[model samples]
Target: MAVVSVQQVSKIYGHRLSLVNALNNISFEIKSGEFVGIMGPSGAGKTTLLNMIATIDQPTHGRVLIKNQVVSRMREARLANFRRHELGFIFQDFNLLDSLTVRENILLPLALDKFSVAMIEQRLAQVSRVLGIGNLLARYPDEISIGQRQRVACGRAMITKPTLLLADEPTGSLDSKSATELLQYLTVINRQEKATILLVTHDAFTASYCRRILFIRDGQLFSEIIRNGNRQQFFNQIIDMQATIGGGGRYNAITPGH
Candidate 1:
């Protein structure tokens, strides 16, 4: 079954004066255990679309459904609770708390939900070992390298065993080598945990890691390409599509007012 469904969604800022359509008549579905990429040029509403799916923003019209539940119309308090338990987020900046130890950071979600100490410990053990951050659990965020920090962030997101994982420029802050490594780790998580993922990135190389991609332009889905055989070839195809769509250079992260 589809884990996420967006149907004829649109986002409008103002009624008439100074109006902005962040997304227009957008529709798509992501199946369970699928790794999908949303790619677009700057100002193409990739993040806005991601925000809708993440339950961080409600669309002006239409619906967003996760596991058959309507997310856009959910009350704020319930939505907040649902997001904490069901949806996991990985951001470009890692978003780890500076004051907390790595172990604390990874367990923040469970702690917020008041999971038992024993349960939290079990979750941390499972996720940390899978993400390869178990060794750095006692250290503070500042004490770790960028790659390790990103892995910690990934562990934090996955510790709750969320149904769907949302990554917004997850590899943006890392070097090329680190980015590749992190992407490989994400693939492992997707396969082993059977987690559905929606990745928002502007880099063709980043999107290549996904099983399929949705291309957006001017707030609408322009195209979609499924990976056929080799990932290296698919990466080149993504680049070619990006170039054709006027995305010249690599856009590692979204810049406001692009």
Candidate 2:
């Protein structure tokens, strides 16, 4: 089943003389357990499209449906609840609260819903073990390395077991090694936990981790490439497509799984 259905969606800004169609009738569906990526040059509407799916932004035309519910039409209060409970997010900046310890940050979602104490602890252990942050639970975010911080961000996002995970440049702030490790962790989360992920990144190496990719250019769906072989081959394909479309993607010297 399709976990996300973006049907004939479009977003416009300003009006008349200054009208900007940030997204133009974009359409796609991400099925359950699929790992997908969106790649494009700056202002190619990658972030705009992601915002629509994330429910942080609305489409000026058409509708976005997640799990068969019309998100664009949802009332404010219901939308807030749905976004909190149904969506998981990992941003470029680790959005953890400094006052909260790693454990508190990871448990915030379940804690808000008033989950039983036993269940919350069970989820915390499971997520921390999977992300290899079992030892960092008591430590504050300030004490951890940048990589560990990102991992904690991952844990907090996964703690909810959200139906769909939206990641925007999650590895953008990390060094090469840390970026790779986080991607590996995301791969494990995608496979082991059967989580549906939609990642947005211009880096071909990062895009290669996805099973399929949607390349955007000039605020539209320029083209797409699916992984038919290994990560290296997919990386090459992403690079070639980016070149053809004049996408300004960096991290060129790096190779995936090398």
Candidate 3:
């Protein structure tokens, strides 16, 4: 079954004379348990498309559906509740509260939703074990390495067992080794927990981690590459597509204008 569906969606900015189409009639489906990547050059509307799916922005035309429901049309209160429970997000920044212990931060969502103490502990244990942050739980955010903090962020996102995971430049802040470590953890999360992930990245190496990739250019679906063999071969394919689509160079996290 499809876990996410984007049907003929478009995002327009500005008035009639100055109108800009950030996305143009894009359509795709991400199947259940799929690890999908969205890649494009800057200003290609990658994040804009993701924001619509994140329920952070509405599409100017068309709609977004998750798990067969029209999320774009949901009422505010219900949408808020749904978003809190069903959608998980990971960004380049750790976004952890400085004052809270790693354990506290990971459990914040369940606490807010009033999950029973036993259940919260259960979820936390499972997530931390997978992410390998269990050893760092009692420490504050500042006490861990950048990689460890990112792992904690992953734990927090997975603790909810969200229907879909959205990630934007999640490895932007990490060094080569750190990036590889986090990616390994993510792959483990996807296979072991069957979490559906949609990640936006400009780096071919980062895109290579996905099972299938959707490439865009100038706000449209330009091409796609599915990993057919080993990771090395998949990495080469992603790099080739990046070159073909005029995308290469170092990049950081998504911005407001992206």
Candidate 4:
């Protein structure tokens, strides 16, 4: 099933002189339970596309559908509900509240919906266990390592049981080991939980973790590669493709490499 559909999407800014086409005639379909990555250079509209899918931004001349529902046309209030119920997000900055403990941070989603204390506890235990943050529940964000904080962010995003997970540079702030571990966790989550994932990343290594990838350039869809055979080979292909796109590693700077 197609969990997300973007058809001829375009986003324009300014009048004409200083106008910017953030995204231009972009189209794609993301199927359920698939791990997909969006890659591109600095001005390639990766974050723009992710924001459109997250319902935080709307396109100028196209429609974005989530589960066959037109999200862009939904009212703001309804969109908020849709976001709360259908989408999960992990940002580069972690976005966890400094004042809240890891457990409390993970419980924010359910609490917003008025979930009972018992239910919240059950969810906290389940999600933390899945993300391997079960023992850090009592610690505040300042008390844990960057990796642990990112995992807590993951737990918070997943605690809501969202149908689709949208991750933006999730491993950008971690060490190489932490980044690899977090990527592995994401792969496991996708496979074990059957969660559809749309990740915006520029790192070939990170994209290798995805089952498929969509490359963008100059505000348009450029190419795609599927990882049906070997993951290591796929990683190499991504690197070569980025080089082919003619940027001195600037492509990596636009997404995960940040």
Candidate 5:
């Protein structure tokens, strides 16, 4: 089943005098339990497309459907409620509250929804275990390593059991080791928990973790590649595609095992 459907979506900025089309009639579907990646050059509208699907921005033309419900036309009031319940986000920077402990940070979403204390604790335990951060629950964000902090962020995003998890440049700041670890954790979540994820990154190494990738350029999807064999092969394929599409000018170099 298709969990997300973006149909003929176009996003335009400004008016007639100085108009910009950030996205141009892009259409795609992400099936349930699929791990997908969106990649492109610096000005290829990757973030703009992500924002539209995240419901943070509206499309100038066409509709976005999450589980068959039209989101582009939703009212602001209802949209807030829908976003809170159905979508989860992981940012490049760990967005955990400084004053809150790891446990409290992971439980924030459920707490906002007025979930009982018992229920919140139960959900927190499960997510913390899954992300291998059970030991860091009592520590402050500053007390943990960068990798652990990102795991906490992932735990928080998954506690709500959102229909879709949207990650934007999630590994952009981490070192190679930490980035690989986080990607492994995401793979485990996708396989074991059946969480549908859509990640946006310019790095081919990061995109290699996804089962499928969509490459965009100049406000349109230029091409796509699926992982047919080992991850190293997939990574090479992504590099080649990026070269063919004239991307990856600013992307970091990556090795086979790194």
Candidate 6:
């Protein structure tokens, strides 16, 4: 079954006098256990689309369904509950609390839901082992390396075993080595845990990690490329596509405003 379904969704901003269509009739479905990427040039509405899927923003038209539940029309209270129970988010900056230990951070979501202490501990162990952060659970966020911190963040996101994981530029702040490490961890989790992920990134290197990529242009679905064999070939194809779409260059070249 599809874990996420976005149908004919559009997001508009500004008044009638100065209206902007950040997203224009976007539609897509991500099935279970699929790792997908949304790629685009700056101002192409990649993040806008991601926000709508995350339920952080609502579309001006059409519907967004997660597990067949129409989230676009959900009340605020129900939406908050749905977000807590069904969704996981990984941000580019590791949004960890300095005051909390790695273990505590990973258990925060369960605590909010009032899960039993024993249940939280079991999930903590499982997710930490999956992300290879089992050894760092006792450490504070400031004490761990950037790569380990990202792993801790991943652990927290997976502790809930969420239906869909939404990642926004998850590797944007890391060095090349650290970024590669985190991507490998993400791949492991996707394959082993059967987690469905939809990642938003402008970098070809990042998009290459996905099984399939959707390129957005001018707030519309432009094209899609699926990985057939090796990742190196997929990375090369992404680079070529970026070049064709005027999104080529170093990572800095494709910043928010380019």
User: Best candidate, lDDT-wise?
Assistant: 5
TM-score of each: 0.94, 0.97, 0.95, 0.93, 0.97, 0.95
lDDT by candidate, in order shown: 0.89, 0.91, 0.89, 0.88, 0.92, 0.90
lDDT of 6 by residue, 107-189 (tens): 88887687787888888888988888888988999999998998888888898999998899999999888888899999999
Query: Which residue pairs clash within candidate 1?
Result: none
Clashing residue pairs found in predicted model 3: none
| Runs of candidate 3 exceeding 4 Å displacement | 249-258
Choose 3 or 5, whichever is better by lDDT. Answer: 5
Clashing pairs in 5: none
Compared with the true structure, what per-residue lDDT tens digits does model 3 show for residues 72-176? 889889899989999999979989999999999998778778678788889988998888888898999999999998989888888899999999999999987
Model 5, range 1-258, lDDT digits (tens) per residue?
999999999999998999999999999999999999999888999999999999999999999999899998899999999998999999999999999999989888887687787888888888988899999999999999999999999998999999999999999989888999999999999999999999999898899999999999999989999999999989988988888888853255675575
Model 2, position 131: C-alpha lDDT score:
93
Q: Write the per-residue lDDT of candidate 4 for residues 1-258, one digit (tens) a residue.
A: 899999999999789789899999999999999999999887789999998999999999999999999998999999999999899999899999999998889888887687777888887877877789988999999999999999999998898889899999888898888998899899989988898999998777788899998998999999998987777777767877788774335344333333
Which residue segments of model 5 deviate by more than 4 Å? 249-252
**In model 2, what are the clashing residue pairs, if there are any?**
none
The residue pairs in collision within model 6 are: none
- Pairs clashing in candidate 4? none
lDDT of 2 by residue, 1-258 (tens): 999999999999997999999999988889999999999888899999999999999999989999999999899999989988899999899999999999999888776697888888898998998999999999999999999999999999999899998999999999989999999999999999999999999888888899999988877888888899989888888888887888843355466755
